[model samples]
Target chain A: MDLANTSLRQLASALHERRISSRELAQAYLGRIERLDGELGAFITVDPEKTLAQADAADARIARGQAGPLTGIPIAHKDIFCTQGWLTTCGSRMLSNFVSPYDAHVIEKFAGAGALILGKTNMDEFAMGSSNETSHFGPVKNPWNLAKVPGGSSGGSAAAVAARLAPAATATDTGGSIRQPAALCGVSGIKPTYGLVSRYGMIAYASSLDQGGVIAPSAEDLGLVLNAMVGFDARDSTSIDRPAEDYTATLGKPLKGLRIGLPREYFSGGVSSDVAQAIDAALEVYDRLGAERVEVSLPHSALSVPVYYVLAPAEASSNLSRYDGVRYGHRAAQYADLNDMYERSRAEGFGPEVKRRILTGTYVLSRGYYDAYYLQAQRVRRLIVNDFREAFEQCDVIMGPSSPTVAFGFGEKTGDPVQMYLSDIFTISVNLAGLPGLSIPAGFGAAGLPVGLQLIGNYFSEGRLLQAAHGYQQATDWHRQVPDMARA
Target chain B: MALTDTDLKRLARLARLRLEESEITGLQGQFAGILGLIDQLQAVDTRGIEPLSHALDLGLRLREDLVTETDQRARFQSVAPQVEEGLYLVPKVIE
Candidate 1:
């Protein structure tokens, strides 16, 4: 069997059935990563020795009859998540040499579940830029088309999964880091209800808007991964406190009676004709399954891009203040005084994109400008949230295109930050409203690139969202379409 | 609403970044174009609506006002460029 392309659930069963040893599986993936990742640029770092050690321990645990659901499954994580003893560069020069003292809560949970640590993947500097072009490490090229972008922030994690460098990976989405890239790469990924996954020790980009998520081959795999990664942690004040439920329990459940919302604004303008056709076709599949489709209007949809830019950057400005050459990162060699050292070190460490956001954030938050810009943006944010609330009253699920268009070539919009930010317009409002959202492969665009269909759910409805996405995956083969370049 | 080199320099300083003159000019052009597009948000009437921050409306749930600190000082300082006597070191400010 081609183990590299299999889902996490299937791999877990194979491990339990003695079809393959965890160490052997780890070696197979690590070897594949070594051979393929340089061309793909999916990983920022891969520690084979450390990876094999964890795999060995997992194999021993199974031998001792103590294996859990995720035990021995290999997964890479976005570099933003701090891992103790491993270099955690959030795709920026600022924390280039910084080694995390403690593991992020997600990383800690995965270790407890006996997951093999494959490596850390690349991303945009501090999870900014929608196309992965702003990364100080260099743009992560799409495996589908090397000249094209792989999508941003969480682009490395999405690319890694798409290229089969890792079976599953932990990714964080501030705006659309998880969902947009998943769509661009033709993979299954979900950004759970805000606070579903604890953010303790994860490098903060936008404090109020960031959430750790998963990217994998199928919605079933995403379900299994999300179930394992979520729960309340005392360390993260924002962590949700609901009792844990099996996220994959309804994977094969029928979609009958499910109310899918089709927002009119999403279908009109912006979205490519090919993407709209695919989404419309998806709605037909839901109809054939005895589900009902309702027309819903999120009148404030267009305002999401602006509201998010103001609020996310405002939080990011405050959060990123910790990186001032005092605690960690590159310090200036020549400094006459302490003040010069702090200023010069920061000026050198952070890249241009990070600087832009910090500047934009600081300006909006400055005394005279706060009420006019930051406060007003916050007010608009609530109106957008209310729009979602009224729509959810009519539909259990919201369906739309993940991005207005498919992956554009690298440098397509790097010069224009607004055009770059518009790439995430469809996915940002979920963070604003604190709702759960998922992205699954819908079909191919006119450019022969993958197109993603997004499923937005009411808050804490991750299970229902996965069930709908899984049902769609079962009937169609979109998720099964691998880029010829990345396949075996 | 066009951003100038002066605006770029001020914003860059507020962000603690030092850009070459060339980069500032490039950024100034890009920022001007972006600002022109984002100003459309001002047309909406959001006068009375409350601004939403967190997804869930729930307020902070305090966890027993207890102090918690880890002894990962050695691990934390391992990445610091300069350190001495259990504290980060920098050039003398009052020497």
Candidate 2:
């Protein structure tokens, strides 16, 4: 079997049986990275020395018969998570030289699990843009079609997994960053309910909407990694205190009697016909599995994009205030005054999209405009959440297309920021409602690019969500298709 | 609502972003487009709806007031753009 093609679970078993050494596995993935990463641009940082050192440590643990299921498995992380002693540039020049002094909670958790840090993948600067084009590191191309964008801000993670550069990679979703990219790149990704995963040291995007998740080739793979990734940390005040669960436990359960809601707003205009057909075909698979499909209405779902733009930026402008010239970020060499230094430094540090969001944020929160824009958006957010609440009452989980369309060519939507923002319309509401949402590869659409079927469950319903996704995945081979880059 | 040049300047200052003269026209257009898209919020009558601050309504988690971290200022300051004697340096405020 191809080492890169193996699943995280299969790799774990192989490592446990001494069929492969961790160092050898790391070297194999490193070789693949060195060969394909130049064209793909998936990773921002890949340290062979650090990766081998971690693998050697895992080998020692395995030698002592103390190996966990994830021991010796290599996983990439989105650059948004702070990794100690590694360049954690969240795809922005502001942090281009900033090596993290500590590990993010997600990074620390993976380390404790004995999983080797393969590398850090590129992302939209500060998780700001839907397409990876906004990255200071340069755009991460789609693995399936190099001319098209790999959906972002988790584009690098999604592309890496799609191309089999890594078995799995850590991602964060605030306004569909994880799910939309996964859809475009044809991978499985899950954004747990807010507070389910500790956000400590994961750079804030939209505070309330941001949640760390995983992108891999299959739901079973996502479940296996999420099992080790979720927990409460006192360090993060928003971390939820919940009993640990084996997310893979319900994977084998049948989908009989499962009620999946089809939101009317999702199928309306904006979704391409090809994507709609793929989603419809996916629902048919569920129907064949004895699952009941119920039509539900989320009338206010159409407003999620508007509400997200307001609230996410409002929080981002505040959260990003810490990146001043005085602190650990970019600073101008010449400045006449303190305020000029702050202004010029930020002006030079942030990208166009980031700067736009910050200005929009500042404008919305400014004295006279606060009530009209920020407060109004917040109230509408409640209405969107209410729509989901009412919809869930009619069904067990909500189903829809992850993205309105498949991956578009580079620079297609970048010209129009509103157009770029609308690409996330389908997945944004899940973040707004703080629900567990998953995107699984259902089938191909335009140009044979993958289409993702989204599964949204009520708060803390990750087990049910994963079970339903796994059920669908087992019945279809869409999740099994790999880009030629990996096969080559 | 259309944003005037004065309004854009005020927003730039509030955001602490220094916009080059060349960036103004483009930014104004982009900001207008975004604001126009966000104007959709105005169509919804949210008079009785309460603004949601969080997705989950969980109460603030309280913890004992204690120093749980070691002093890593030296390590932290190592990455600062300008640091002197373990202090982060900025442009002088006093003459």
Candidate 3:
């Protein structure tokens, strides 16, 4: 079997048929990670012993004829998710030395499905920045172009999947972390409706906005893994109590008379010509597949960025307050007093971007500015949410550019905070409105870098979104194009 | 509305972060840009609109007031930076 090109379904079939053992599959991925991760910086932790042990257990389960769809499948996880014994740093100095004593709900689910932990991939510190540059481990390089960033905070996961180091990796989306990185790295990712996936063990960034998702080679593969990832966990208060879903149930469904919403705001401007062209080409494929395009307006679309900056920071500040020196994170060696310890420990532990957001959050939620900033932003958030509600009424799924441009070089936007924030302009509103959004490789753009076409669906429409993206994937080979480096 | 040094200092204090003198000016400039972007929200008319603290409208789920957790204080505190005798050590607060 060609490991690099094999889909999750194919891998499962191969494993069940005894063509490849689980241990061999895990070893193969670990070997690729060992050879390529040094240049890619995609992984933060990799333990061959732990991986083989899990693989061996999976082999035992398979021998007993108890294999599930994801059993023995090797999967990488974003370091943000707490794995029982793995180092779960959300790519920060704060929790750099902290090992999780328990598994996150998502981690537990994957383990229950008999998936081996490929490794812990790196991420932006506390999921704060657009580029993986904010990660303490170092920025994950784009597989297509070494100097370019794999868009973050899930950059490591996207890079890992893009380079075929792992078939699929768990990721999270807060203002497009998963979709942006997936787009930049030329892979597929989906952020399910908020609360569809439990956030119990995922390290908190912006609690209201953060939702776990996956990055993989195709939308179909995403469905196979998401089936195991999404479910109600009583531990997470916000988790939706719903019946199990077959995320792959709608794959290969015909798109006849499907209404694709073209948000006039997203297509108006700011998008690079190369990206715009790629999206247009993708739309043509959908149009030929018997889908109808409808122009819809998200009148408050421009306000999404401003509103997200306020609410996310405000929530982040509150969520990150848990990182006081009293707990498991980093603490200052010497301090004059308790207050000094708190201040110095936080200062030493957090990176510049994390500190910046915390400060921004603090200022917004502080006295005298609470009603004006935090409350006002929340009110505006309602409007952004309403915009999607009104738009989705006239369409089945919304399509647009995931990022304004293709993957940019490291340090390109890191200097300007607003510029970096705008990198997620096309994606943040989806989170604000609590919708499922998917990004699939449409084609390549400037310098032959990949461009992603985003498909946004109403709440709990992951199945439909996957079906639509799968329809496009069936008609095109963009999702199959691998980088030369990955082939090496 | 650019933030003054006094404003930055107050925010740092509230955030429990210690900022160096050299980093203050750069942070101020960056904050100015970020806040300027955030300031755009002030122009939107949101009269009578209820604030949304969460994406979903679900109420907090209530479970029976029973302890579902096992006593794993040792396992929990194993990763603490400073721990002794089942307690996390911090700088003394008492006078």
Q: Which of the two candidates, 1 or 3, achieves a greater DockQ against the reference?
A: 3
Give me the displacement of residue A31 in model 3, in angstroms. 0.6
What is the TM-score (0 to 1) of candidate 1? 0.97
Arranged by TM-score with the best first, the candidates are 3, 2, 1
Model 1, total clashes: 1
- Residue A291, model 3, lDDT: 99
Local distance difference test values of all predictions, in order: 0.86, 0.92, 0.94
Residue-by-residue lDDT tens digits, candidate 3, A246-333:
9999999999999999999999999999999999999999989999999999999999999999989889999999989887889989
TM-score of 2: 0.99
In model 1, the runs with Cα more than 4 Å from the true position are none
Select the stronger candidate by lDDT from 1 and 3.
3
What lDDT score is found at residue B78 in candidate 1? 81
- The 10-residue segment with the lowest total lDDT in model 3 chain A: A1-10
True contacts kept of each: 0.69, 0.92, 0.88
In candidate 3 chain B, what residue range of length 10 has the lowest lDDT sum? Answer: B86-95
| Highest DockQ against the true fold, candidate | 2
